[model samples]
Target: MAKRNRKKNQAGFVFPAPLAVVLVVLAGFSLVYVCLKAKTEALGQEIKALESRSVQLRQDVVREQCEWASRLSPASMEQALKAHGLVMTWPGREQIVRMRADGTIDSSVIPEVRPPARYARVDRVVMND
Candidate 1:
């Protein structure tokens, strides 16, 4: 009777320690996995935010380029030139007045021109003596 009881007790207790060890190892692994999962999720969110910002920056660049293109169009340039009294005459099509040896255009057909004087006005103050 004692031998049978001893054998039964040994067999039943054989798996407890190994099962407890396995449970502990599994718990530790689960904790590590949860931490890693959380970190990976955070990194994914950051990547998504950066991608959205990059797209927005690209769109802004395209919009600015379009605006600049419109502003620098040939018609706009011609209008600006007209406002300044400048004409885009093709090469060899302009009326070239020949310059004389005195560094002046030939006065036979062209009149001599002079620049206007520039002046600034100052207000005078009257003081009582």
Candidate 2:
């Protein structure tokens, strides 16, 4: 083929090397930023999950407390004790004696805070003279 009307091919655009390098660096920085953002979002989700678990545990504790209160109600405890043939009564003034306060435990008749084995097992110990 004969080259006809070939004046010049100087119509192409030339990109600057330093500007291209800067654009490449900017692209690298953008990639690093995107990675960090993704990691941050994942951590946020984990935090939300932990918070939900904490809330659920707190709710469970509250429910347990309400159940415990219901079980420990006066009516229920009295009924249970009566059904078990347990009689719990306060001690008379004569049954309680004061200590000498001389670093000695005064006890002529020790009061029983715990019910009999047939009833509930109380955690309190009553010391009286």
Each candidate's number of clashing pairs is 0, 1
For candidate 1, write residues 11-124 as lDDT tens digits.
463557888999999999999999999999999999999999999999999999998998799998899899987777653413346798989877575534446423445689
Write candidate 2's Cα lDDT for 6-122 as tens digits.
457565577988999999999999999999999999999999999999999999999999999998999989989999888888766555656677956568655556543344566
Candidate 2 stretches with Cα past 4 Å from truth are 1-15, 90-129
Worst 10 residues of 2 by lDDT: 110-119
Each candidate's root-mean-square deviation in Å? 8.8, 11.7
Q: What does the lDDT read for residue 11 in candidate 2?
A: 58
TM-score of predicted model 1? 0.50
